[model samples]
Target: MIDARRGVLYPDRMPRFHRLPPMPEAQHLVAWFWIPEWDLGPGETSRQDVVAYPALNLVVEPSGVQLVGATTAATHRDLTGRGWAVGALLRPAAVPALAEKPSELRDSWAGLSAPDLLEPVAAAMDGDDDDRLLRAVAIMSRWLAERAGEPTDAGLQANAMSELLMTDAGIRTSEQAATRLAVSLRTLQRMTHRYVGLPPLAMIRRRRLQEAAQRLRDDPGIDLAALAAELGYADHAHLTGDFRTVLGMAPSGYRQEL
Candidate 1:
């Protein structure tokens, strides 16, 4: 079984990410609940660079369901007091089939503005029973499967490429990617935009900035000029300018916050 906990980052004081082992029949879906330490307020809006997945996330504690998107990273803050969250991950193609539009799903099932689904979801969270949450996930899966059908191999490939564009540091150019895929540059660009939203170059810059942010957070001592060169920026000034544009803060300011 794939490790459901791998993608999650839990602070030291909280319970480790928890999940029921994947049953053979339901390997396509993974469900889990997390109760984070109540000490930190939500962190700054970290730019999550992810490819769009055709999945729905139900926030049980506050009660809501949202269609996940690829446009930007979801913002998160540390919550104080004990709180609970349950999330369900589904195949990517299932998303469009399940909702009228992607934005509609986000509107219906996220944050303080959730649909009536919130009440039951919150109730399930408050109770110790797993049946209710499991049932909800099963119902959603069945509904999506009926409408969306199973994911296609092409769709999976597209999704994989999209993820690599956003997260993989080594993937730097369309020419390099085309060489790997044995396709023309034009073909790669078109396919990437269709699946990943942003073009290859834009995605590369975004990923670099994200890495820079993480580095700043983890080590305040990284010199700005060296950091710029490390990320492939032409010069320190170029890095400074781009960092301000993407993060709304200077590199020094960001480092100080660490």
Candidate 2:
């Protein structure tokens, strides 16, 4: 239930965060659903940092629903009051239904006009009972199934491309991704641009960066060069450069903070 520390930067200080698997009906559209609830006293604030996954998200709050695009860098949010949000980490098959030009929406979010979804989700979160979250997810699942419909042939191929890029450590290059997916380099690039809003190599680099950060967080005394080599980087400097570029700090600096 509690997803805890995959993309999270600070596992120890995270508020109440839960990750739920998508219902069977919506599996083609959603990777998973995430809920985070936080309650803080006056004058207190909690800042949550994340190396976000390279995918779009459909988020619902008390106010409304928003379609968030794939992020190119690390992100942080400051929580200052009592609140919560439910979000679906959307798969590539679902992107075209929500955003026609995925590249145009990169690093930004647009408001979605779906009052039918907002009402029941708000009602579910109003209660403190345990099953309320599940009830809310079920409602969202039905909505997504109706809105996105079924995947097309190209959409299914795009989904496979995304899965391979995110999960395969051997896939260090976009050419390799294209080869594994049985598509030309041009086709792979086109598919990712249309469905993922990012280059295939960017997705691979994101996965490697997330793994590097996790390894550093879990093993403070581990060798940096070894970590970089394991993650398919050229050397320690390449790893440090990636950290500084995306995380705004060097790997050693980040470890010191932890």
Candidate 3:
């Protein structure tokens, strides 16, 4: 399955990252809950970067909590000391329930606004940073597990569009995606930009780069040429360029880090 936890464009950083299954009832709206921690020895520093996924994230750190919107570019967070975070990765099509429209949160991380989800989570958080995260996740699971029911309407439509862009490698252009979604290019653009925080074609490109990063991280020895073709790149050179665009390095450079 595609990794629901996006980012980490530089696998060589050697930070600890893990994904745990979300509550069963919340699975449709949440991909997984994740906890990542890093403790660089004294005088050491590490930078973790990711190209980001087209999903909202509710992140809780020792300092505070944030409702992060979909990001449009690769980003990095530099860490110098011990730090950790608990994050809930939203499903592609699900509105954060916190935002009136997902687009309203684009390129931003806001303080908790979804009372139904945040109130319980914050009240339950306490103790050590990791403990606070664990407690928060437990509360989150319960909250989502008991919600009215599955997502509907626009949520379904947004998710369907996202799955098409991520899983169907043949789609590489806006016209192709608009046809596949059976909507006019203009309509597709509007819906995706509003719902996914990215234009339809940009979402497709993001997924491709996201997947390429994971594949390289998992299997450093994989053939770049073959991988390029599998990911719908026109050639190895094209793949290299795409990787550079999203990750700041070519596939070989990333693999070398591994």
Candidate 4:
């Protein structure tokens, strides 16, 4: 579980026992909810189930998304930039609807500049008496809905896939993903490429490497070989190779920097 203060915006809680679905082979639009808070609980003890948003997330502080989990909860504090934020959730078929159209729906989704959406969101967040947050999300939802025909689109699908890959360590190839999706490998590849940018294998490797880096930073004494095995690497050397590829530094060096 996670915790939040009276006033702080944070990411949403990760869904447990739930997984994201596969991306469609067509274009789509996506929207995200951001919450902010004032004061949060002490660190090291607070935890929350956080579902990672698949696309680029615009995190605004002073006010942000309220992350709800099954057990723990906390308000997230702004560690970087100002309370105002604008970001993008770029994906292939999952482009923002504004860039494409009903005809292009089969090929790409629309892309939104966070700044465009942030103004309304910020106004809502700034008010003491306004349905600002709700209205802002509603506006975003309407915009996305008009573009993609669905509130959640290919971006969300890719996010769910990423979470699954991260949780399962890795899935080896698109064939595995296809099996899960009940689609052909080509179809799955196209969908993944459109919605996730990178292929499935690359995504899996990236997540594993990211996990390894975090482990090294938090606990240098973690057994490299075991860590490699846990992340589904062939061996420590293989894991080390990937670590170098993604981070441009060996795990040991990464730890040193930490």
| Of candidates 4 and 2, the better by lDDT | 2
- Candidate 1 off by > 4 Å: 1-61, 72-84, 87-124, 128-148
Q: How many Å off is the CA of 63 in candidate 3?
A: 2.1
Evaluate all candidate structures by whole-model CA lDDT and list the values in order.
0.51, 0.89, 0.74, 0.45
Ten contiguous residues with the weakest lDDT in model 4: 1-10
TM-score of each: 0.60, 0.97, 0.79, 0.55
Best by lDDT: 2
lDDT (C-alpha) at residue 164 in model 4: 59
By TM-score, rank the candidates, best first: 2, 3, 1, 4
Best by TM-score: 2
TM-score of 3: 0.79
Off by over 4 Å in 3: 12-14, 113-135, 144-150, 218-223
Q: Give the TM-score of candidate 2.
A: 0.97
What ranking emerges by lDDT with the best candidate at the front?
2, 3, 1, 4
lDDT of 3 by residue, 207-236 (tens): 888878888877888999999988888899
- Every candidate's CA RMSD: 6.5, 1.8, 3.5, 10.4
lDDT by residue for model 2 (74-141), tens:
99999988999999998899998899998887888999999999999999989999998998899999
Q: Model 4 — TM-score against the truth? A: 0.55
